[model samples]
Target chain A: MTRHYNFCAGPAALPTAVLERAREEMLDYHGRGLSVMEMSHRSPEFVAIAEQAEADLRELLAIPENYKVLFLQGGASLQFSMVPMNLLGQGGTANFLYTGIWGKKALAEAKQLGFAVHMAGSSEASGHTEVPTQAELALSSDAAYLHYTANETIGGLEFDYIPDVSVPLVCDYSSSILAEPLDVSRFGVIYAGAQKNIGPAGLTLVLVRDDLLDQRCQRIPSLFDYQAVAEAGSMVNTPPTYAWYLAGLVFQWLKHDIGGLEAMATINARKAAKLYAAIDSSGLYSNPIALRNRSRMNVPFVLADERLDKPFLAEAEEAGLLNLKGHRSVGGMRASLYNAVPEAAVDTLIDFMADFEQRRG
Target chain B: MTRHYNFCAGPAALPTAVLERAREEMLDYHGRGLSVMEMSHRSPEFVAIAEQAEADLRELLAIPENYKVLFLQGGASLQFSMVPMNLLGQGGTANFLYTGIWGKKALAEAKQLGFAVHMAGSSEASGHTEVPTQAELALSSDAAYLHYTANETIGGLEFDYIPDVSVPLVCDYSSSILAEPLDVSRFGVIYAGAQKNIGPAGLTLVLVRDDLLDQRCQRIPSLFDYQAVAEAGSMVNTPPTYAWYLAGLVFQWLKHDIGGLEAMATINARKAAKLYAAIDSSGLYSNPIALRNRSRMNVPFVLADERLDKPFLAEAEEAGLLNLKGHRSVGGMRASLYNAVPEAAVDTLIDFMADFEQRRG
Candidate 1:
């Protein structure tokens, strides 16, 4: 049985090795009589698994001791509300740098939750094809936290450098997190849903600097109370156990097979460069984003002839390159080169794109 | 290769056939060249899987056409907050029948969210070993809704009859739903964390009558707003795709191998009766709850001598009867006989119990 290279933005491809190990242990994990899914969340076995996943994540990211790593449920979309609910206390202004659809959604959720939001900066004027430079950033005078998307999965834009700021910085690193080395101490909070680089779609990883945990709004839902959740060790609710286990395996794969985040970043950059070079050289395809801001994670490109988009995607699928469809907001194709997406897949995708352009040129 | 009877109260055992099927499809679901976990939630394939899971569940429970089923993230604990946030609008008085730990937690969350709560009835006075009789119920006239725990996982207590009520009735069926036939028309909403009787953890199933969808609090989190989630077809955010698929497979198993809820109810009765009979007839073991109020799902019992508890649990584990330890609060042994725990396992458990008692007594 051959495995296909999947290019979904989130809920994307996982390391083949992770899937194989999980499949082998589907019914009995580590000689335990029951599958991991059947184990109680509070059991010694599951507790150890959860703890190890967090520990490995902390090591891979080199997280500071001052930060608390929380394994939470609900996707990052829930964090959109949770961030404001837990941070924007009375008389605090929420600041947002809106770059793409995800940032816009986060800002909207904060606003909907009755927080006053200040738009610190925005790339909407450019049709979300670029990111605001450090010089362009504006901070609210009384901002509780400045929020930004590290990488826009839809628009294929990524921040080239961390912005230097006074207030606490909270980043939605959903797509780019684990693909590159990060300085955890620079940010007050870093959150990513598991579907991309981590594991499956249910679990969310949250890293909150210890100082940021106490400023929650009054009457906040207990589950969204970062301080309370941190206190309980992210076990206030029954966590997504299977996703947590899979995430641990992915971390192990990252640590042993792929070295660490630095190695991951090197490989990811190489894959992105090869694919983007193919797009740049071809007269039949184009990527719209600026070179400096192009995301190494999600690479979106369009066919020169719009009519060929369907045929390109269809033929790509036929070749076992799956889920190459871009987000609806952005038409054409997107190749999400997450950590699990091997360099060979990108090579194959590049070759396929070249062949397709030749056949349709 | 032998699989054990996993008696975990939550994250309990799943059918061996289901697990094997999942293993077979881990690398490629239906030759799609991707695991279900890797599929985009919005893809046609995933959309079909999600829709089919809901449809199968609706059919299995005979849920009314007017009821909308939402597949959500976060376990039942999150629902404790969401139920009130969505149902208890301004000036609303929430009523709760506090039976056990879960119900108490729900009430506490509702009050913490600034909603006034009325204790309609409670079994805490009886150490949660019995359910409140019909005459003891005291729902307020001005209450927004009356909520109850259909089954208490820790207490080993279950409501034998649905309460006759005037206010909208909400039931937390985390430990009981789909184990037997449920009259969906009788309740305004039924919410269950999938870990228990459904599928894996992290996926929550909420069945809300159409009319209750619109009465949400003004500042409800977008993900927690039932109306918006139902309208978006549970794709408001990325779902627990694998769990949803696993649940669909379980529904298929129930329909084909088990032959629907009526047949399930019959088998469950026999299992519960046999387990309870063994405990009662044994001189060394006894159940604390009133027989009429006992749960057919979770059977908690205490051995006469506390010193033998460790040995009993250790020997049980050696014999492949896993996760039979009682809840920490209960301080006894619990044998959860969810649908997946076969009768043969129960017989083995009873025989083991009898053997242990004869030797230790």
Candidate 2:
């Protein structure tokens, strides 16, 4: 079967090797006589699968021994409410640096849920074309934790430097968790939606320092209580078993196939650099983000003429590139070079963009 | 590859045909060039799959036009919170008819979440051998809704009759949904976890009458708000895309391969009957629940000698009858005869049981 270049922002592409492995084992995993989807989460096979995935992830990220990695359901949207409920239970303000839509949504969820919240800083003044510098960020005196999105998928803005904060550092690293090496000890909690660079949509990855688990709110749902979820090994109830297994496959791919995040970072940097260079050189295309803070994961670019948007997307799809259309709210073109997206996809996209410019510019 | 009989209670067996279709499309869905797992939730292709799954479910259950079917993440455990948050918004006491572990968990969630709750009725005094009758159930004076589990998977108990309540009726139909014909108009809201009879883990299905959508509690997470989720067509966030697609395949299998639920019910009835008859006739085996209230979906039985449990499980696995061990809380054996388990699997299980009894009795 012919596989096309997929560039959707979230629920983006997966490693072809991982997909092939999943396909080979979809009906019966390792001669277990039943699909992973049908197995009990508590079964020996699935538990091993679950543990290995977490272990592999820990190795790849060099996570500290005391951190608990949770494979949970409900993705980042659920985590938005959970982060505040868990971290602010001892009654400190939830602080956020809103760079784009996702970070804003995280802030909004906490605010709507009646949690005391502080918006420390935002790039809103620049139409989210750049992230506020560390000097511009403001942390409240009683901040429980400072939360930020590492990479804004829609806005195409990445934090050039981590916000230095006195409080526990938390991050919504949904769009760029495994793209490069990370200092896990620097954050109290780091969570990512698995749809982007990890595996599938249902499973969310949460890595929390052991000290942070105890402050979870008492009255929240047991599933929402980080302490309870961790105590039970993230299987308080039936987890998304198949999705977790698929994520394990992805972790394995990252470790063995891509030679861990160091190698992945190298490849990702090159891919994004090539695409950005293509846009910068082309007369018909332009990107708005500040060069230093430009996202290596998601790059949103626009054509010279607004009228070319529809044809650009259509022709991109015809040339075997899909999901080139940007977020609906922002009418433009975006190519998300997630970890699973091959470098060849960027090369092909750049060539197509060059050809299109010659034909229509 | 050899496919064995899997009787996992929750992340139970799926229709082999459905699994086959999923395997075929695991790498590239209908030549779309990317796996369904890799597609955007808002993409037209994935949206169509989501809508079709909902539509098929509505048709299968003869759901009322006013009801909204939501394909959501987080299983019944999350619904334990959402139900109270949504239904108790107007500030009435949540009433529950507790039969077993699942129902108790549902009640405990409402209680722990600081909601005013009433224990209307329960069969706990009788060791959960039967469900509390409609006449025995006590609805509170200010009952916002009366909630109950349609079938307790661990306790192997099923409600023989629907409770007639003055207030709205909500049921956690997680284990028994789609086992037979259901009157969708009877309940105000019915929810089930997808792992059992629907498809795989990670997807939860909620069918709620339109009138109940309003009155959701203020300050709950947006993902937890039923009204917002419904209005957005369950697209408030990225859903478990591949799980939803697999569920769609299952719905198609139930409709086309099995000739809908009537034929499915007949087969399921026959399968459950043969197994129960085998248990009743065997000197070595016994099921605890009352015959009429015994779950047709989950049949938890014990051998005459508890010492034989381990060997029985080992032999069962050897015979290619997998996951026959009961819930860890009650350590005997349980055979879940979900719609996908097939009559042949039941026949094979019965023959194995008879042969085992003859040798060990």
Using Cα atoms, each model's DockQ against the true complex is 0.84, 0.86
Off by over 4 Å in 1: none
Residue-level lDDT of model 2, residues A32-151, one tens digit each, is: 999999999999999999999989999999999999998899989899999999988889899999899999999999999999899999999999988898889898898899999999
Q: Where does candidate 2 clash, by residue pair?
A: none
Give lDDT tens digits, candidate 2, residues B62-101: 9989999998988999999999999888899999999999
- Given the true complex, what DockQ would model 2 score? 0.86
For candidate 1 chain A, which ten residues in a row score worst on lDDT? A84-93
Each model's lDDT = 0.91, 0.92
> Any runs in candidate 2 off by more than 4 Å, and if so which?
none
